[model samples]
Target: MKRFVGLISGGKDSFYTIELLKQKEYNLVALVYIKSTDIDSYMYQTVGHEMIPFYRQVLDVPIYIIETNRKAINTDKEYVHTLNDEVEVIYDHLYELQKKAVFECVSVGAIKSYYQYNRIKSVCDRLNLSVLTPLFNLDQRVIYDAIIECMDVVIVKVACTNLGKEIVGKNLNVISGMRVDNWCGEGGEYETAVLDAPFFKKKLRIKNYEVLHHPEEEDKERTVFFMKINEIEVLEK
Candidate 1:
């Protein structure tokens, strides 16, 4: 079996990519997570990332957590090698891991963001590792339907006016009936975290949490909501 390193962000798309790769007989040997200092990073997800450690227990795999300042020093359509860029930070971490263990490829879950996809591909190209993106360019509605049907996902963050604090901590299924800019949250409409999935050994239950609202400074009509997970428990599936 070909060994692959899975990039996890504690989000629906990244986690779902692991499930897709496993189905194709890829060996998920290790997981990599980037802890960005910037909460609003264009290249990474920072909301609800504090819960990422629990995923190691759920997936039964070793995880490597790296920290980045989340700087977009190189924002060009084609990425260039720069030490300060967030993408280079990812490359540096993966490069070091490759020396310790030889993995054939890396897995990603980019749906429609060519900017993200291209940057990741650039890193893998330099490392001589193949990039596997199972969810690339797929229809958002189709992906949303599949995710809700197979996994237990929760809304962790809302950045659009159409959604508010009331939507926080709710199941992803609830948003299906409501009108939104993107079904899969691809347009930054919202963000999600997986509580349970078929590949997980256990499920997460949020015992206590607080919803925080941050109104946009320039746009009074828009506000961002986040579900701060104060307490969580692991349960048998």
Candidate 2:
């Protein structure tokens, strides 16, 4: 089996991508994640990242949480296809992993963002590591159906006008699976937290959490809400 490092977020798409690779017999030796202190990352998800520790506990794998926060850079709205200062940090983490053990690939969960996908690929290209994006440009409905069938997930953030606070902390099915307008919460419309996945040893039961909307002072055309994970308990299937 080929050993590869998977870049994971506590989100539906990333978890699904990891499991899909596992099903194909990829040896996922370690999980890589970025602790983005800044919220506006052009390539990574920043919302509801607090649950990463819980995900680590369930997967029982060595996780390297690299600090990839670059506040001064990436202020431009114009998206670039090349790796900027932020991706260099990610490349450093993967390089360390390669030194520890030989790995051929780094998996990502890009779905429609060409900027994100290309940036990750370009960064991996520098390290001679292959970039695997299993969810690239797939139909959101198909991705949604596949994710719900295997992973137990909840919405932790909603950034679009179509989503509301009521949808947060509920199952992904809370948003109708057939709804094409905002399915899979792709393109920053919303974000998900994976409580349970097939690779997980136990399922996550949300014991307590609070849904908080973005402050009114920073309000935009649409309201955004995030679920603050107060507590989670693991259980057997």
Candidate 3:
């Protein structure tokens, strides 16, 4: 069987990529999570830092966390220059996952962002591995519905601009129509992680969730909320 490594961001796009690739018979060996450095860090199209561990547990996959943090550089050209440094750091860790023969393919959750997708493709070229993106060309709306239909996802963090306050602890199903369109559930408008899904041996249960609102005080900006998970319980099936 051909072995591969999947890069998971614990969101709809990554989750959908995994689902689609599995159907195509790729031997998924491990998960690669680019751990968040700080809120200001690139976040690699992800939301929060705390959600990584939970995603690993639910998927029952051994995760390799890559600390992609470095000094800040704002411009697109500067960002790409820094990316080379970050990819080197991650490649060292990726090498250790399967020491004998490096991963044949590196799966990413890229959609419409050419910058993001090409960055990963460049890394694959350097690492000598194929870059697989299952949801690369799919319509965003279709992918979002597939996630809602196939997985048990929960909202965790929302940027302080959109519907951040009302989403804390609310399951994705609650926001079905124009509400999701407003948030761009597939994009990086908000961030989420999976608690349970069909492939899991057992479902995950979350308890003691607190809704935290961080209001922008200086210039009358919007207030965003975080679904702080004080406690969680993973029950057996």
User: Which one wins on lDDT?
Assistant: 1
lDDT of 3 by residue, 89-177 (tens): 55566667657544589888877766567667766676688889877767777777788888888877676454656876778766675
* Collision pairs in model 2: none
After superposition on all C-alphas, the RMSD of every candidate to the true structure, in Å, is 1.5, 2.6, 3.1
Query: Which regions in candidate 1 have their CA more than 4 angstroms from the true location?
Result: 215-219
Q: How far does residue 1 in candidate 2 sit from its true spot (Å)?
A: 2.1
lDDT of 2 by residue, 79-173 (tens): 34335467667777777778897789988888887766776776788789888888898998889988888888888888876677788888988
Question: What order do candidates take by TM-score, descending?
Answer: 1, 2, 3
Q: Which stretches of candidate 2 lie over 4 Å from their true place?
A: 72-84, 177-179, 216-222
Better of 2 and 3 by lDDT: 2
lDDT of 1 by residue, 1-237 (tens): 989999888889998999988998999889999999887787998888867888877778789989878688888888878777889888999999998887999998899988899999999999999999999999999999999999999999998888877999999999888997789888898998889988999998888888877544445654788888988888899
For residue 78, give model 3's deviation from the true position in Å.
10
In order, the Cα lDDT scores of the candidates are 0.87, 0.78, 0.66
TM-score of 3: 0.82
